[model samples]
Structures are given as structure tokens and as C-alpha cells.
Target: MWRESSNIGRNQTSSYYVDNTLKHSFSNKTTAKQKSNDLKMPQPDEPYYCSQQIQIPPALPDILKQFTKAAIRTQPKDVLGWSAAYFRALANGETPPVKERLEMPVATQKTDTGLTPGLLRILNKQLGPRKTVDLNIIEEKWKDLALPKEQFDELVRIGGFGGTIEWLRYFALGCSALGENITDAMKTVCEILTADPDGGPSRIPFPLFKDLYTYLAKVDGEISQEHINEVTSHLQYYVDKQEGYVQPRNFTSPDCPKLS
Candidate 1:
């Protein structure tokens, strides 16, 4: 009987030990799994794919921001007019008239103070009766004239002289005092008007001529009624006789007489 009791006791002890061992193994496995899950957690510095946070883009440069604002505020309504003024400023080796300080000069008669007949004569002699005057010629003549830079700039600004058309008109108006024998003047103006931007013969749209006339009339009282009449008549002739545009040939041909 004693021997049987000892065997039973041994079995119970063995069973208890196995159960304790299993429990310890299971606890260790659970702790390892928990540690692995903790390591997988995202750090504060790392952005998670599932995160709802949004990053803002960097701001524009101060200069760029200012330029954008200025552009928005000062956008021109008349693109052609603006272009003319801009180009004229560039041709004169001055800053473009788009700046706020360079407002369009007042179109009063007092503004015509410096445009003397002598100056006009000088320009006429330089341009001559050429069918197409080079832009470089006009620019060089402008410098040779040695007119006050400030005054000339003011005239250009007020006249809204944007391109070759305005430059020609400015000289023509100044020369109007010489009477109607403006053959060379008419030819030069026509050349500039009809010449292509890339070089070669092109047509001058009537609307541009009209715009130029209107602007010139407002700026200079010395521009005679005959000048206005002649310009209108020529434009009408082109519309009726030629196509809606005036080509270089039209100006060079005998049909279009000198601006008398």
C-alpha cells in the first residue's frame, strides 16, 4: 500500500510541473509578440499613410508676389495701345511706360512746347523720301537731334508712341508747319505701317491707323485738318480701292501722292 501511494504522489507532482512549464512558455510567447507590436508603432517624426494631416506648400518669393499683385492691379484694357507705349519706351532706350510713375502725359497743348520746326526739319532730312526707313535710322536720328531726353521722353509718353507708327506720326506732326509737301513723311509712315514685324511687305490694318490718328489728334493741335483729311481719305481709298489693308506697294506707287 505504501509503495502504491508513493507512485501516485510522484505522478501528481510530475503533472503539476508540466502544467507550470506550459504556462511559462505561453507567457513568454505572448510577451515577445507584444514587444514586436510595440516596435512596429510609427514614430512621431514619420508620417503615416493613414494620417489625416495636410502639409502646406511654401509661399511665393516677395518680389514675385509683388509683381503678381502689380500685374493684377494694372492690367491694360487696350492691349495694342499698351504695346505701342511699351515698344516706344524701349525704342527710346527708356523704361517701359507700364510703370506706375510713368503715367500717360497729359494731352494738353502746353505739352507741345519742345517740338520745334527746326527739329522736325532735321528729322525730315534724316528720314528723306525712303519707301521703308529702318528702325535703326529713326533711333540714330533721335539721338543726333540731341533734343532734351526728358522732354522727348515726355512727348513719347504723352503721345503714347508705342511702335514705328507713333514715331513716324510724332515726326510728321512736328513737320506739319513746313506745309503740304510731306511726300517723304507719308512714305516713311507707310513703310513703317506696312512693314512686317519679321521684315518684308505686310498690310496695315485700318483700325491701327484710326487709333494712331485719334491719339495724335488729341496730343498735338499743330496736326492740321488737312493731315486728318488726308489720312482719312487714304484709309478710305485703301478700303474701297485696295483690300481692307494697305501694302508697301500702295504707299510707293504714284496712286498715293505726297501728303500735301
Candidate 2:
């Protein structure tokens, strides 16, 4: 009796499988019908994927920092103020000054304010010397490839990228020199803080600085510790400035009288 019951159960299972195969064949025909219906559908009165669009905040810190660096490096203090005003205007969703009147994209749009060239020159001084810098290249490459605000803001918290103590010090001094807007330098420091060969926490602190000096020293096939010392000396200047009362520290002078 048990063996007969087991055979009956197996037969039921086989019947179910055969029935499923038939159902699937019918399901494919149903899908085809659904596709045709979809093709013939009328537009809705208010067709939207979602009832409400999501709102994302702009990258305030990165925008502020990069613009500030470009401004200070390219222009005088007065112009830096104008640049700051322009940066604020953009941040607040106002039209910026124009450079031949073009539209800005939602993600990577820029207000011209007619002063971008000046700022670009300053940035170029530090990150340029491009082989063939052109208007299109500046508009497309530099503007487009700049670090997004969030990533840069993250770097400010993480010390900085490329593992260079001197670069970090440069940011510290630049921040201090900028007075109240030193947060700008902090943002810049954050953007590239982890662009080193060994990304994340595994990198040595001063690789870029030391490597740069070494590369320069070996240009004529000979290296020297003098270059290293010079780099060290410059880094020391910034370290000393931290002892003072500045909100963000400045690079210190080696010749100044020692503080008690």
C-alpha cells in the first residue's frame, strides 16, 4: 500500500510539471499581448516616473574652495572679493557674470562673471603649463573634470591626498592667508588627498613632495639631498605656524624670534 501511494505522488508531481509547461507557453502569449497593449497606450495627462522629483543639494564647500583658490592665485585681493561675490551668487542660484553668454548644465554649470580667465591663469600656474591649452579645453576639460564638491569636502576631513606633508602645509597656509574663507583651502586639500598611488590609509605622508624633489634632482642623472632639505625647510615653515593663534595656521618664518 505504501509503494502504491508513493507511485501516485510521483505521477501527480509529473502531471503538475506538464501543466506548468503548458501554462508557461500561454504566459509567453500573454506577454506578447501585454507588449502590444503597451505600444498602443495613450499618454497620461501628467506623466511622470515619480510623483515628486528628488532634490539634491549643491556641493558648497568644493565650489567655494576651488573658486577661492583660483581667485586668490589669479587676482589681487579686491578681485578676490569680486570672485567671492560671484561664487556666492552661483551658490545662491543667481546668474553669474558672462563669458560670451552660454547655458550651464544642472550638474556642471558655471556662471561666467567674466573673471574665470583670471582664476584659470592662477590654477594653471599651479596645475597648468598645458601643452595646448585652448578655450574649448578650458571650458570642457578643466571645468568638467574638477572634483565634485562632496568628494572635496570629504578630503578636508581626511587631511588630504597624494600623501605630501608639504602639500597639506600649502593648503594650511593658503587657508590662513585667505582670512575668514580658509574653509576654501580645506576643501582643496580634501579633493585630492587620496589621489596618491597607494590610495586610502596605506600611503606615506610625503611621497609626492619627496618624489618630486628626487625626480628634479635626477634630471641630469645625479641626485642631491639639497633638494630634499629645501623641501623639508619649506614644510617646517608651515608646521611652525600651527603654534600660533590663527583659526587656520599659516606658514611660519624661520628668522622670527622664538616664542617663549
Using TM-score, give the best candidate's number: 1
Residue 167: error of model 2 in Å? 15
lDDT of 1 by residue, 1-260 (tens): 99999999999999999999999999999999999999896768965664446554455466446544533443544445545644565467654423232223323323444434434544554454553455455555555434446655655565555545434555645433223334433433444445465356556776655554544454556666777677667657766665566655654567664333
- 174: Cα error in model 1, Å: 11
Residue 32, candidate 2: Cα error in Å is 55
Alpha-carbon lDDT of model 2: 0.40
The TM-scores, one per candidate, come to: 0.29, 0.19
Any idea how many clashes model 2 has? 8
For residue 17, give model 1's deviation from the true position in Å.
Answer: 99
List where candidate 2 sits over 4 angstroms from the true fold. 1-140, 143-204, 212-227, 233-252, 255-260
Maximum-lDDT candidate: 1
Q: Write the per-residue lDDT of candidate 2 for residues 139-227, one digit (tens) a residue.
A: 32223324233433333334333332333232333322222332333323322332334233212234443443343334324434664
Q: Candidate 1, residue 175: CA error in Å?
A: 12
Lowest-scoring 10 consecutive residues by lDDT in candidate 2?
244-253
- Cα RMSD (Å) per model? 18.7, 22.5
Off by over 4 Å in 1: 1-148, 154-199, 214-223, 251-257
